[model samples]
Target: MSSLISTPIAPTSHTLLKPNRNTLLRGDSLLPKRLSCTRTRSSSTTRALLSTTKESVLKDFHERRALKIISGLQNLNKENVASVVTAADKGGATHVDIACDPDLVKLATSLTSLPVCVSSVDPAAFSAAVEAGALMVEIGNYDSFYEMGIVFSPEQILNLTKETKRILPSMTLSVTVPHTLSLPDQIKLAEQLEQEGVDIIQTEGGKGSSPSKPGVLGLIEKATPTLAAAYAISRAVKIPVMCSSGLSAVTAPMAITAGASGVGVGSAVNKLNDGVAMIAEVRSIADSLSLSTGRHIVSEKNTLRL
Candidate 1:
């Protein structure tokens, strides 16, 4: 028998968090125009890109415009992770993603009141996170694997999902589908992951993309890979799809329109040197998500080649 222990509750389709609608941003007085200028997206373009026909009911957490701030798995400095985690909670993000190190989990939970989600490729690692107060366990956040020239095959991902479920049978689990596979393959894996009882499926591909356009077009270019995956995966899986990697305030709404219930933003918030800027970026993405959620629109001219 495995060392892991828990009362395996049936998984629900929502994140462990429930963000307040525009709660911190409203208090911060973040303006759409400020976001438009800083992010290189036009408000008119936002309206156009966000306009969509509703296809399904999103999980209740999605209606709140889920934003999860990622403190990179490689980022282990308690002070740095604490800054990101604090900003996430202060800015009204639904949760904070940290390295799956149990000490990091303890450090993160101590910094913020927001629910904690721990990311690691190791299933056995999640047990410590659970003991350290991680509300959810994630088997994928593949961006770190890319710099080392490693790619996760579908079979490996499924095995990880299985092993993770075995270890933390009762913990809320989210798995990421590597964008290395074709869109069809991605959709297929997402369907299978859901069957494995994953509560959420995250999509990542920023490292695989090379944007040719300038300004806002470039921003859209960078986000295309994950957005395409979200579009396909959301349609195929009942579990929520979190569009992550290479996403920005400009493209966050597009992810929501593409069928992602929430977005996992990393560099946008974590890369900032100051907590105030980090908080502003989180609010900007949240604001963008809120404006376009529950309403999906295809732009008049296809902004994305996909």
Candidate 2:
């Protein structure tokens, strides 16, 4: 890696963060009045940007404790999508990750002031979502593809990043490093992604993992793959690493401890049957991420200029 792109974070030892009380609140409770984006479709694209000054997604990634709630890339039901988006913002999530569909992006934007991110493996899918008010775009979670025995090669991942950038160069781009790759290869891919102009790198596990232990130990065992990848890859790339998949409130702090700037949770929130349950789960993850990440935060913010 060139010196300009060699800025990687060194993982540090950090204690597990204690869980906070689960205080569920209505979506309206966060503000005296609800916040809505009144901009028309044409103007929304102008306001939705990859970065902002004070509370930009970039700043949150720099802070290293941001929590992202995933509503599934395949989930398209209007009611279910709305419920998940409401729960994510009300539960204190830094952002909500949803399917890269124009309709879903519009629905998410109509509901909250929090940054709305859309995800997909196809680069063509992002254009409509961006026009619909999506502020962030992500490629490849790959967790859903495991059941179909589909795996992405490093070359495919790099191409996806390139194509997505070609479509929306200014959009905050996040690409997931397939957990299927060896740790060293994962790191190499991350470094290349930085060179490709991806703003963030996300790591995933759980679909391909089967935990042998039970209870709390089982949860840790389940999260081990992604957490380990985050430790290795975050140390090899200048961009912020978002540790995701198979993570719960119990292991979220472990991700930040491993040098990830944030955690992306999917099934933990989306799998819940009710909106209230989803809100509670989101809060729990936020609680786990309350640890002091002072050292890693300082290192990343200074080394990263993208």
Candidate that scores best on lDDT: 2
RMSD of 2: 15.9
Model 1 over residues 244-292: C-alpha lDDT tens digits?
9999989988988899888898987888899899988887876776632
The C-alpha RMSD in Å for every predicted model, in order, reads 16.9, 15.9
Q: Please provide, for model 2 over 168-191, each residue's C-alpha lDDT reduced to its tens digit, 9 standing for 90 to 100.
A: 667788999988888888889899
Tell me how far the alpha carbon of residue 186 in candidate 1 is from the true structure, in angstroms, after superposition: 0.5
For candidate 1, what is the total of clashing residue pairs? Answer: 4
For each candidate in the order shown, give its overall lDDT on alpha carbons.
Answer: 0.77, 0.80
Q: What's the TM-score of every candidate structure?
A: 0.75, 0.78
Evaluated against the true structure, the overall lDDT of model 1 is 0.77
| Candidate 2 backbone overlaps, count | 0
Which residue pairs clash within candidate 1?
51-296, 51-297, 52-296, 52-297
lDDT accuracy of residue 262 in candidate 1: 86
